[model samples]
Target chain A: MTHTVLVTGVSRHIGARVASVLAADPEIGRVIGVDTAPPPSLSSDGGVPLGRTEFVRVDPRGPDIAKVISAADVDTVVHMSLVSAPPRSGGRALMKEQNVIGTMQLLGACQRSATVRRLVVRSTTAVYGSSPRDPAVFTEDAEPAEPPAHGYAKDACEVEGYVRGFTRRRRDVTVTTLRFANFMGPGVDSPLTRYFTQPVLPTALGFDPRLQFVHEDDAVEVLRRTATEDHPGTFNVAGDGVLLLSQCARRAGLVTVPVPSSAFQLMGELARGAGLVDFSPEQLRLMRHGRVVDTTALAAALGRRPAFSTATAFDDFLRARDIAGGLPAALMDLLTRAVAR
Target chain B: MSDVDRRVAELLALLRRRVTGEYEVDEFGFDPELTDKVLLELVRPLYRDWFRVETTGMEHVPADSGALVVANHSGTIPLDGLMLQVALHDHHPARRALRLLGADLVYRLPLLGHLARKSGHTLACREDADRLLRKGELVGVFPEGFKGVGKPFSERYRLQRFGRGGFVASAIRAQTPIVPCAIVGAEEIYPKIGDLRLLARALGLPYLPVTPLFPWLGPLGAVPLPSKWVIGFGEPVRTDEFDPADADDPMVVFHLTDQIREIIQQQLNELRLRRGHAFPPFF
Candidate 1:
């Protein structure tokens, strides 16, 4: 059992939920939430009781993270601070620093610490890279036919490389990397999320690749299990089954505007420029070819079955989206049914 | 309610149920509903009218348990896989949908790949085949692969080497019977005369066949020849007699594979003699 855990990226929704869940567990001795900013208060009616987690302000990219880890004498470290999108101001350079440089410093801190025995890093399936030549389902051991072209995917690839290096040096530490599919749930912000949230969804003409999603709750639960348990090695974390991109849009109640691949590329750039969207080129590639990861190891080796499948998670996200938009429960139900049909 | 309204309501019910809870889909992303709605519908016409496919020995396929359907793959554009899928669904007493193993190229094409999955086709991998068999689902294999599909017109109906007998090993491991399937009249559909090597490579295709009509008549030439098709399913080769450990024995796998190949090739010869001609009008 893990005692006195340090959870990074607590300012984010997933990190905060994980931190709170850990705090509520009677077996865990202490819960420390670390981020550059103060964590938002857990709502009054939240499942996990508030005020149990001790908040610490520390940037993972800086040297102070080491001090926090040493001072707390944390036995387990859950790194969830990896950014999925580029910052509005500094863009690529800033994202690289936050993801790559931040991971290096965090790993450096854990390497020097005598108390830390377990480390869990949040990664994405983007490392596999979408390509026409890729296999139908990529096993954990499959090499990327084409390396990540740019942005978060390339950075994620680099971050994983560094983590592997850390593993080689500190063979004693149990390193678990969870490569998640596109996260879809209430309050999760991602490029795909933004695309679907829009009233009109643009798709590449004549292309509808398979898509996968993991509910935010399942994503958080898997992280907690990894921190509390002792599963090692890399695992692909995605809910079962897949949906076509068109199916996703129809479920989301969005109007799909099919455009040629070249025109869609131009529109993506223009949309980003106009601040209407942040559609990255790599994401565009993903939309066209679609990406899916095999989750056999996640269940067989890691011993965790997700509560939701891809279609259910997506439906739940849509349910939440419709409800938040002020549709009554019954009408939302009817709308979901009608759209699904 | 009127008939249209009732259909609308039923449609709504289906959508609502699909959105509400988790139902089961196989590991390869098979969707029975969509398969019925789209893929089978598209193939039904070709299977029934265009090709006029006639199937025999349908009883050989087990009703309740898994069996491997190993067939000779032909036609430059391989419609044999789809035809077999329809035959199993329509002709067999069990009406079990055969999970046809497909090539990587099938998965590479965006729209084609999506439809293939919904239609219960998966990558021709050992892991998928093993899992499907263990689940007691009937699985189909076209071991001849691109070699049989892309062979020249002169080599029509000639059986190619089955790839290393991986399917036999999978069947042995799963303890499932292997049913040899032979598809006649598929070879003459495309009549592949030449291979456009440079164009095929540039297009990321396995091989671009230059049929007599193709490249001369443009897209119109690409239509299939509508040759009469016959599918024969041979008796199951029992793998239960061999210990599951024999799956690892390469020699056993090879011998079994060769035996299955001979069965299929012999069936093909018999089918030709029975039909009397490669293309018999309105037979």
Candidate 2:
């Protein structure tokens, strides 16, 4: 029997990739992609159709999401929808309402629906607040810190709590929460990408914190595994290796300027306040701490190794951006992609 | 001033003198290590601005031995731990360094990994605890874990679950005495105005702790209010006296844990009564 799956936030980036991957699976007969935004234009690149996927333009935060999912007869729900960027002036409040309320509503839907048997919620490594980096790395059980900033993440965590709690009440529903590290690949527009794309990357003065990046493909694979596998509880989904931010930028051929840590912190605060950046002080703290999560649990659960390395991921990103040959290559690719689009 | 008041004042003055001059240079030393700098820079201003820290029970801490100093972990953050370390090293006659048994959360950060290791913090793992104790080090354990440190400001002084007497087990296994220490001021440092657990998890932090002034005021607000800190060490619970084989006995563990909790609670009550303030008084 073909299993129907519901994936939220499937209009863009990670969600879209997840949808495509799931749709390709023989076991997953149909995938209902939920997102607030309009679905991206799906077309054949190199005479190969991506896959068959259905787009549902409905706000996951709305009460109607459950109805929509129930109508679709989704057997599994992969909650990938979230406001990934830093909250705006009122973003935190919006995020809380959307993420927390949306999750509750979704959980309610799952409870009411007989078809929905398993749920996988996409979480971030941001849940683990900044700590002193350990060489041994953080396992799934690593307790979170009270982050000084990033209020939205806290709300998201509450959603996870509700989901986990819901599982205990209903023995039938199996839930898995994946706390992913910094993910980079095609279609990602994070601060790391911004730094790489910029002519001059701004770095904290006197500090080059270690960073972990999971390629988009690897991220999708982990998500795919989570959606299909029977693993329960939370796991830290990270890449195989670690790299410094400066190293990433240098490898990408981006120039870097050492900005005072205080200045950068101030800028970050201002950006968060202005809704220009999504990272909280706590997120910055983790970034400063250079998180290296232990991927043992994730690996054990997935039963496979992640495909991309930090070097290879960076190389792939450069190739995708057409910046492999350096400055000229980056400019040409940018112009060409712009023209093509 | 009365004689007792004069003596207490003189002792405080003498301790301050020792801390600033001989003690700081000799014991902890004016090392340019970041943790020391972080402790000095972050704490000193608050000390000058808001706190008049007084530390007692310096003698209970083993001068040179692998002793497990188990204390009730409170305060929004472990500001008490930082202060206690500073106070113990600077005030104690032996100037023993405290190797804190931090939670798994402390050892999870990237750059903080080195800092925590360098600052002598290990995972609250029994193996780590055993290793540190066997090495003749003073190990500090806050059995309360996150439950204690993340307590709401309203229930600030109230102790939380100490995790089934693991500290006692560790102490017994290592044959070290468990010192019950009470910190008076930490609860007020960053009186948790609110906690957002989901946000905490997203940032991969323990709790999304909001001080009354942080985030809104940025770094300036991050400055902890100098609440006059009083650290008191109670009599040690001798682990050597207990049968090591009885480590797995629930009754034995429960009694020890209860006894430790009572001692800490009593000290907290005493300090509160003596201080005569709803919150610790800033200078």
Candidate 3:
């Protein structure tokens, strides 16, 4: 039976890719892509092709979202609009409103729909707040020792709670929550990516936390798998290994200035307020004590393994960043010469 | 080239490799080369010249495959674990790297925690232990934990209760051997005469030990006493003989745990008998 898949947040890269891949599949009958704004169409960085797609301009938070879902008779709902960063200059509050209210409204729509069989929600590992008391690795069953205090992580935790409630009410729907680790790739833009772009990364003094990353391709593939396959329940999606914050900075060729924790937090706040970067308190907590998620369930239950390990993902990110930044080869040669002298 | 130039060149090369993402780091973020260059080099003097650790029954350590080295914990600073790592890494026939299971406090400390991870020390939990052993890595466990490390000078070398025999269950689950190990002289390194409980609570330390030198002598006094050390390994007690389901049996776990603890206590006693002085001026 061909599935009528309705993908939310088509304007976003991963969501667009998910839509594009599903639309191309022979098994999928029709794809319905929905977003508030039309996706970018520039050839160089154009959105992924939504082949045989019926584009619907509808806000997930609005009542119109229900009409779109009901009219399409969608069998699958892939909720991808849960924003990790401020999509535009809307600031954090707007993003939170979009995430929480949007998820609530969309789930309501899915519940109302009789045809919806599968629900794939894109959650994040940030739900597992970084704390000194946290276990070395968090399995799917492990509760967040300290709930995320603020920002996207908080929103994610709330979103998962809503998803759980939805699963109980609509027991027929297969709910797969993919809590992705800090994702990075050639084209991926995230808070971590922005943090690395800085010339001098200010690290917390005396603290070097272990970090994990999933390659953009791996993340997209995992998202695709949940949407396409029959895997149910929560899965912590991440690449195989971990990297140190210091190691990440070193690999990026950025000079690290170890600032005291209080001072570092103050600087981070200033940076975030100035819109110089996206530095949330949750990110600071992450830097203080890194969180690792166990992906044994992803392999065992989901029957999928990421192609790139954490270290390799980080390496690729650095390589892509260098090429993207257009760091001159001559500058490296000049630095080498000066150092030799 | 001069020794300084060669050393600098080697360091520079290592830095380049690290920066260029050539050097491999393991799943736990363990950089073997970096740990060797930095941590091993720093601990070499203390292991070789200072503590002067003498090892025996190292043949008990399997040439390959996973083995859990259950040892007694001592020393106010808990330097015994690091020294044990050095011993196995340097002395074992296969030069096996000991993946020590450290206390939570070790990972709570800032700079120290990062180094511990890079040096292949993970949180002393069964999940990590089970995984490491299954991967065929030799693991070290100090079951006595803080009770052993923070015990008073008068109670030095006295074994503490091994918490619930979690490590034994892990060994059984992994179907690996438990190599009982004991290290004497660590207890004398920083004899904990008293514990500043109030200060420790305020500072978030397990215990603020008041040694003869520490606080009184300041930072200089923090240097460990160069006591003669002996690390004795016992024959590997095979856990493979038992059914895997027996790991859940508390009776079996407790019995095996006591057996290993007794072996370590016996080794410590033997080493103590041969020791001449606490801090002999010359070896």
Candidate 4:
């Protein structure tokens, strides 16, 4: 049977990739991409008219979102929309409103849609909160960490509640919530990217905490399976590999600068106070400890290996920036000019 | 002089006898002295030098009766349970050997099964628990089961499913006091940062835990740091006091489970405050 999928937040990096992957699948007859952001210029490789995937520029919290989504004739709804930018003015409130009201709107739309059979919600590992140094691996069954300064995670979980609760009324629709780890790949430009890009990477307390990352492709694959596959319940999606923050920085061709724990804490406090970052004191404390997530259920459900490694993901990022071999040509030229001067 | 000291000695003697008798084997050319040697040498050294392992409310554990000791399972590996066994034998009032209710996977392994049996662990089955309790033995159970031990590092200290109150049911049938034990510092020993469920199922394990280092670092990852552990025993939930008919009631079981969970959580909180650190420093 040809599956028609409605994927929200399709303009975002992960969401766009998910939409493209699903649209390319031979089994999927149609894909409806919904996002508040302006549509990307790239066309689907399948040569299907970009308009066929119907990009709806409607706010998820608004009443029009349901009407737009229902009009797409979607058989499956993947709720991936969220305000994920580093918190701006009222970013936390926006995330909560969008996540909670948006999910309710989408779920309400799905409820009315006669063809909708499944709902896959993208959640974040942040829901697990900061990792403690002990028992480093987080399992699906563990208690969720208390809400952090980044309210997106907590709100996403609340969104999950709506999707999951909808399952009780609608048995036909299976809801799968995926709590993803740090996702990195081509075009990835998060704070961690900035950390790696820094000429001298700062180490926390002279001990670089361990980091876990998933390749964007693998993340998309997991999302694809969640949308099409029948498995229900939450799963942690992360890379198969774990590396120290220092190792990641070193891999990115940056020198490590050891900093005292007190200094790191002070810097973190200042950043939080300035609203430059969303991490809380508790989250900061957790950053000292490395978190390993158990991806057992995700791998089992997906039935494949992750598409990329930490090294490969970093390499892809470097390639995307056109600095795979060394520094970019422009930067190299500037350095040479300075040396000449 | 204290009841705990006398009981500890008795349990030590009992363990020694059992180790000599039922545990003695040379099938795989196993060293007869390995168990004793580990108990006395490897474990004792760390127990003495690394950190202070303390246990409180030993009297809560009945001195001469079969009691179900339900503890919060942590420590990515089962090191917490092993340490608890050592502490109970070295400090409890009756000093009775604890028969750990292990996951079925432990018994499924060849060498691991033999060693587990030698270590006095059996499948965490109701029948096994019932049989042991009826035999007037101390049966140790981590009702949080794999979920507690296998929890992601982010969700550390959060308890998991209590397994539908089977432990309570077993204790009630045997009229045993369910001694609730809260174990702190175990979760810090081997942090489980991620889980690869595919790998876990492929390996026939409950959850393939990616600890701080495991497969990449090999055995070093398995060697959990000896964190100062505090095993606080809460007042036992007396199953005998409850109506037998209430045993099947959902509300009765829920209340009992909640009470036990609260005790464990409270004790964990108190222990955390007492330590003032996530883990005891390793010298």
Candidate 5:
């Protein structure tokens, strides 16, 4: 019983990699990579070529997406319709519209179509939001401290709510929502990576919040497993362990400038104007109070531990970017050598 | 290498581990290496010399198993918790680290929160408490919270009402024993004479304490009074006798909470008499 999989947001790196992975799977009969634009020189972080995945230039916001879903007899719809890169034209507002509306329209199609039974929506841990009052480790069932006021976190929140509603509409669909930690490693560009790679990283003043990172390869593998398998439920997918924001800086060799949180946002706006990094309210909130989610459920469902821990994933990121032996790392190495002798 | 050089190399190696971020913090962010090498080292002097903290019933605290150490919170500055850590780390035969459950305010600050986590302190939330207990780690809690810390000088030794008996429930859930801890000298360290509610509200603190030397002496006054402290650990109150399901039963939780509270109060009374003077004649 081979399956035809329809993957949305195929133009993006993660989406393209997911599509290509499915396309290469022997169990998958056909793979339809649907997005408004074609995938840009697509391949996974592991160099898994985007060879067999068929690209269908279709807007998920329009009815044509439903037509394509029906025509292809797609059995699994991998919905990762997210755009988190720096603002290009209309900024956050347009991205919000694209994310929420695209998700809504795609859900409508999935709910109506008989062929669509499996739904894998790529969500984020950002939905949990950051705060001093929240739990140290959030299990999947834990309620968020408070819904995010605005930014991509809010958008992810709304998108997840839609995903929940989709579950009710189509009871037969095996819905798997993965709230992934910030993805890191080479062959990827994210806000966290951008911030770390910058000559000087600006941090929230007086805070050295604990952080977690999921390697891009691990993320891709988990996405692939969830999409192909029958695991039905929202699971927090993150590498084991945690890192401090300051440790990340020391490892990345970036000088950190501490800005008061009130003034931090203003500094963010200034950086945005200079085309350095776009810092949303949610991101700033994370810098102030970092999030750490429990991945016990994921481990139970997947039947294995992630290959990379948080520390190792960070090390991979530094190595891939050729950022080995940063400030503290180099200094520590020298001290260790002299002492060892 | 000479003996001095060998020791220097060992110290430098530890420094390298810390500087290179080679240390591991538990899931709760308790850096054992840092806690043992740095935090406890800093607090030991105060515990031994300044507080001159004497211990009783060290035999009651389990050698290697998970147990909740419930204590009375005092000292206007809340140094009792640190002293408690030093007591367990230095006095206990196994030198086990106490993973403290802190108030939300401890985590709301900047460097304070970072240090709290590194020292194995977390917000006194039910989930974290239960998690630590399940991991078989010793957890310390000051159930009195701010009320115990902020009480006026007149009401110094009296214990405040425990907050809904959360620590008791956590102990039950973990099916571990609760070691009732009583610290006698903490209440006298900074005799809180007054509280300014307006300033407290403005600063978003629980209470703006006016100690005898605090405002009058400025920064110099912040130093705690050198009192002869006695930390007595009462016998372990076994929660394993009851079913773990009892954690949900409010009546059982209430009963256990009162029992533990009474044990600590009784211990405090006895220890207070034993110490005789806040600034002891022996000192």
Candidate 6:
């Protein structure tokens, strides 16, 4: 297990934790963290400490990462830098460059580095773009019902394509792509987390798409476990079970206003414009047709189940929020009893 | 407490569970609690009173485990599936939930799609059907799809192409028995007299049906006729008798599909004759 690992996206929560955890492993001799900005000190996002990880700032636009990969003699590369949405600071263009081109540079570097034996790329289930034609449950091999056209989904798809190309070029490298479901935890700040935590959720009219979740703790655990070992090929990583958006709103004590699908996207933009939330088109379609992936392949590869199911993960997320509205608990209780009879 | 009090207490406890989100659904988003408590209760009236649906050969439905119920699809609006669901739930000895495989259009709609999934139904794709059968669920399929549903009123009960025999392949792969079911009287519910192609095209619907009272009568015509119904489940056609590899053989799939189609068609004719007029009392 003695290897020099180069971890990308060290600036983000998941990357920082993965780099920190891998650095802590005694068998792993060195960890080189690469990012545009320096690692956040004593990160409060999740309180994960950056342990003995040596940070290296390199411009993602250029071929500088290639130099770092070869010079550090990095044997294992953990590419966790892909962004799901255009960040508030960096808009869509910048986000796309960092996700797509940045991945290309990193994979090209990994391809040239003969020492790099294993590669773990963090992917999203969003690649399986939402549509009415989708199956009830998506297997790893299942194609997206509606192929992504733009935004973060297209970026993720392109990144996966480069990974596939790299796998073909570097046959010796064991590539593992983990397509994760919506990340839900108290510490996580995802598009879905923000959407769910809102006081009033504007759901797509008449659509209660089934959604799955992966807890932040379990997400870090999966990344850490795979970074150390070899789990070749793509796997859909998520907790067992699913939750309807309506059910989620009810459980979280939030009132939902159903907007027609025609107006849902516009409404999302209006909310975004109001500076209430960062609502992207990808997120909008996702809300309209919720995505759920099969996690049996993940369990088989990891040899264990995720710590939290979708329902419990959601409840865990709800515990941290100030649940202030919606129907009173007593009223819900009374109604349920009346309906049960 | 007496028996009445005990039942009341149990209902209250279950209601409390519902409020707390303490129920579970399978990976396919099938909520057994919601399906049994809410959905089944909603459709019970249509089965018991509206259509007065009667059943026969329910013994053929496996008491436990996987079985594929292949039935003829008819009626302009496709309410037969709902009535069939209610019938199986109430009449089956085990009261098993029949997980139907529906057309993509069923899911394309908004509120309708949500309720459909909560009621334990899924897309009519082979993978979903295969997974459901493998899990030992009583999977239901209407192979004729829009073809059977949109057939002319004069040609009602005439079977349509089952579409590549995908259902047969799914059942064979899962090694489940196929229970050929026939539902009479649904064809009379909304008799398709004409199809407005231009209107359907604009609406992006498969077919804009023109029933006697529909279109002319507007919303009033949307109401389904309360026709007498009979659902007969035939003997199970065992797929396990053949090797699972048989699922890959196109000829085997075609033969099985054709055989099931013939059985359901014949069953439909006999059941319709037994029930006499679709709208009358004297049989």
Best by DockQ: 5
How far is each candidate from the true structure, as Cα RMSD in Å? 4.3, 16.0, 3.2, 18.8, 2.0, 2.4
For residues B114-135, write the lDDT of model 4, one tens digit per residue: 4655455666666567767887
Tell me each candidate's TM-score.
0.87, 0.55, 0.91, 0.52, 0.96, 0.95
List the candidate 6 regions with Cα displacement exceeding 4 Å: A43-47, A322-327, A330-341, B2-11
Consecutive 10-residue window with the lowest summed lDDT within model 6 chain A:
A320-329
Candidate 4 chain B worst ten-residue window by lDDT: B20-29
Query: Across residues A37-126, which tens digit of lDDT does each residue of candidate 1 receive?
Result: 676555632233334889888866799989988998999999988888776877878888988898999999999999999999999899
Report the CAPRI category for model 4.
incorrect
Docking class of 5: medium
Better of 4 and 5 by DockQ: 5
The digit string of per-residue lDDT tens for model 6 on B56-115 reads 999999989999999999998888888888878888889988899998887889888878
Output the better candidate (2/6) by lDDT. 6
DockQ of all candidates, in order? 0.26, 0.04, 0.36, 0.02, 0.59, 0.55
Report the CA-based lDDT of candidate 2 relative to the real structure.
0.71
Estimate, for each residue in A34-67, the C-alpha lDDT of model 3 and write its tens digit. Answer: 8878877746574577777788888777888899
Superposition error at A167 for model 2 (Å): 1.0
Instruction: Give a tens-digit lDDT track for model 5, residues A1-341.
Output: 44898888887777878887888899999998887776765233434367688888986667888888889898898888777643467787778877888899888888889888799999999989988888788889888767687778888889999999989888999999999999987766777887888778888888877888898889889989988889999999899999988777766666789988778888877877777787777888889888899999999999988999999999998898887655676677787686667
> In lDDT terms, how accurate is model 4?
0.69
lDDT of each residue in A1-341, candidate 6, tens digit only: 74898999998878888888898899998999988777666735455577889999987878999999999899999998898777678688999999998998998888888799999999999899888898888899998778888788899899999999999998889899989898888768777888887778898998988889998779889988888888899988898888887778878867889989989889889987776777788788888778888888889888999999988888888887655333556776666567556
Q: How close is candidate 2 to the true structure, as a TM-score?
A: 0.55
lDDT of 5: 0.85
lDDT, candidate 6, at B112: 86
Candidate 1 clashing pairs, residues 3+ apart or interchain:
none
After best superposition, candidate 6 residue A131: deviation in angstroms? 0.5
**Which candidate number has the best lDDT?**
6
Positional deviation of A273 in candidate 2, in angstroms?
Answer: 5.9
